[model samples]
Target: MLRETWAEIDPGRIVDNLRAIRGTLPAGVKLMAVVKANGYGHGDLEAAEAARQAGADYLAVAFLEEALRLRAGGVTLPILILTPIRPDQAELAASQELTLTVTDAAWFRELRKGRPAPAPGGRKLRVHVKADTGLGRIGFRTEAEWDALVPWLAAPDIDVDGFYTHFATAGQADTAYLERQACRFAELMERCKASGIAVRHYHCAGSAAALRFPGLALDMVRIGAAMYGYYPPQLTPPVQLKPALSLHSTLMQVKRVRRGEYLGYDNAYRSDADEWIGTVPIGYADGWSQRMRGADVLVRGRRAQVVGKISMDQLMIRLPGPCAPGDRVTLIGRQGGERITFAELAVHIDGAAQEISTALTDRVHRICANEKEVQCPWSSPYFQPHRREATVI
Candidate 1:
């Protein structure tokens, strides 16, 4: 690819991680791979393919557009859109054989009002009813609200394929809130059963819940972060996961800064002595935040500290010795027997690995090493040169 700075995606690792997560589920439990947000910024179609090959029973995305993209890409697995779809988009979603989520009964009625009649011979619109046990975001918040929607869910026009909920604290050590949410969800499921509503799937576990509370893995578990080799710090995964994505870049330039010379914008760093500095072609725009200035990156297996203020498209690192342009740099991955993880970077930025992965911008090329394909968002064709140099300031 053209840019030396790109994300290397290991689909094999994703497959292994999916298998690992699958092993934790009980007999007959299904796995729903969450490939929304571009597969957690690892490339949606690639990750989805890997997960499916590794035995994912279903695929889920955040919106109808994502589901349609997967359909266009020839993905035949049952696809569910987790977020609520617009009333205008309902007919199109159904026509594409996509599953939509219903958060509130009133909203569902409104969605059907303007929704065009289903196409002749088209598949029924599958739907999953979400209950807001305690997340307080979307879904039916009270029992009366959820009960009112059950009868309508069984309408001939719609297929009530699933029922689900979300846990707000499944990853935390405290189980009080988690237990409460689970109890509420259980009560709702019991109500559904008593009302003779057949839900083909019942799920309440995301990555954290799947790992921390495997018992909550009812009919399926929506696997996301765990499939990418990360878990909440407070929770331990039953199976080991391999990181599927790594951020890498080449040393654009190397120069020596005189003692007392300033580095980067605002002169945020001053050299105490003549020091070697290496510039990398990545910055805040690439999801490498300015708050990561003090974080350490792997340079030839040695630790190099980010010294200067991170700019929009570049950042400076203090090198141990003279390093030349074209040297390999590891921003979030293993290199030369050393490793930098998203969790470590999260500690520096006070965020989670999911946040770090999803924050990656489209400008960065996604190189699927296993597939031997390069996914580029830039308009320019892929360019490659044996060697290239950047201007040294």
Candidate 2:
């Protein structure tokens, strides 16, 4: 089945973005590509593979399941789980050789009690201690809390692989808060070092910090949005990034609307004059939100305004002129001389480009394009396209 709506992922573009980011890093600084949220909705396995090929030293995800998915997909790089895992999940995570993050000392004690014994001839579970600094979401918030974890760090059942922290305002123009967070993290690191608890990888820089404040790129950096060609609006990336994902769909129907005719649900839009209208087989269910009613989509390489309330599986676009079904529509990519960027879409939703990309639903097929050819699940032998002419709905 040839799906009308799909997201095209360019691995080459991802590699380019990774390379660009790496180019800006100081020598010996490692890049840990963050592939959480299904690689920001770009397909985790595909994105991780591309990042690995581009020389990412590590890969990070937010959950144990994501790390397991990567391992199952043959990802051999060091995979770190950024989020804390339950005591019950610690053994399974360790069994898969996934690096787990430790936040609270008491929680660590509980995990240690429930954690399964190490496998035969297997190494101890690798762990990274997280310092909360100022994020206030997770990790040890003070020296006392961190000191409480020192015994667990020295336990024979676990190996302390790293220590890290997160920044709350690394991407903003105002660096006061970010500086304070950095200072706190530094103080914690010094305390750890003085206490003879040191790890190889000491990192705090995420994508924003890595790009804006290279000094914070201690041992490694966790890069997410910038690796996918996006950054917060307030900060400028040090290197150019090539977007790896492009959303596209085919027009399913085309019709002539008479003057004063209402379109879509609730009769939200009324045509002021007889005009060409197109129905695209994509809508809120596919991550196109209802708030995008006034946004523009590319039709035949020309901009066409979204005309009415977005539906569950379809939406109406005001075409420039008479058009037929099966015409190509570009939602987030280049179309002839025009382009609809993630930044522009973010403006419509008043969110970051990262949110826009990650919000894309799974109903949309992910077609990965590389130097070889386009690979899609729909291309397999089991899939057969139905022969039917496009018709008005």
Candidate 3:
């Protein structure tokens, strides 16, 4: 890429992670690879292909557009839209043979008004009913809501593909809330049985919950963060997953600052003593916001604290010693024995590992480390120069 900042992704690691999680699952339990948010900013098509290589049974995206993008990219695996779509959009979703998430009966009623024409080969409009057992986001909450939705789901024009819920405390130390949500989901499953609504797949656990509690893996598990190797170890998961994404950049400039001198806007940082300072070509606009002021990167395999309020396109870091403008900077990866992880950055930002990765803007280029294993989707005339060999984003 023309820029010095870039993210290196190893699609092979994603494949390995899915395989590791699969080995821990019971036989016959399907794995739904969640590649929403452009595969959490590691490139959606790349993540989907990796999931396919690892034998994933299904793929899931957050919305209709994401599913359509995947289809355009030639991803044919059964794709489920995790978020509910507008009723008017049903036809488009149906035409693409994409499974949609539904919350209430009213949505179904509206969808039926303009029933989507059968897709190529007469494929039914597949859907997954989401129950709000917890998390308090987009789902039918009570039995009344489910009862109202039952009749619409029974229509022959629709296919009850799956039933699922999201857990809010899956990665937390406390299990009380998670257990409560699990119990509620079980109640909903029983309600489905009583209503004669057969669902092809029944899933509740996300990556953290799935790895921490295998017994809860009813018919399938939606693996997202764990598949990308960002799940926290505190959950005591059975498998080990390695991160597939790492950030790297070159120091654009370096100089010495006197103890009394200040740097950055409004003097957000002041030199404690005569020290070497380096400017990195990444900042808030590039997803490294001011909240990362206290965060650190690695220079020459040594820790360097980010100093001052991060600018829109640049950030300053206190160097260990004198460093050249072309020296490598490790933002989210290993440098010798020292390493900077997403978890560490998350602590500073008070968010999840995904919040850090997903926040990464497209301005920072991406390079696939093992392009030989998974062909880069952007290898076309549009991305020019070294088309056959270069995998850039």
Q: Who wins the TM-score comparison?
A: 3
Clashing pairs in 3: none
TM-score for each of the candidates = 0.91, 0.91, 0.94
Q: In candidate 3, which residue ranges exceed 4 Å CA deviation?
A: 116-123, 379-393
Each prediction's Cα RMSD? 4.5, 4.4, 2.9
Clashes of 3: 0
Ten-residue region with minimum lDDT total, candidate 1? 384-393
> How does residue 115 of candidate 2 score in lDDT?
64
Please report the candidate that would top lDDT against the real structure: 3
| Cα lDDT listed for each candidate | 0.82, 0.83, 0.87
Give per-residue lDDT, candidate 1, residue 22: 86
lDDT of 3 by residue, 197-246 (tens): 88889999899988889999999999999998888745556776788888
What is the TM-score (0 to 1) of candidate 1?
0.91
Q: Write the per-residue lDDT of candidate 2 for residues 121-194, one digit (tens) a residue.
A: 66687999999999889888877887788877866777888999999888789999999999999999998888
Worst 10 residues of 2 by lDDT: 384-393
Candidate 3, TM-score vs. the true structure?
Answer: 0.94
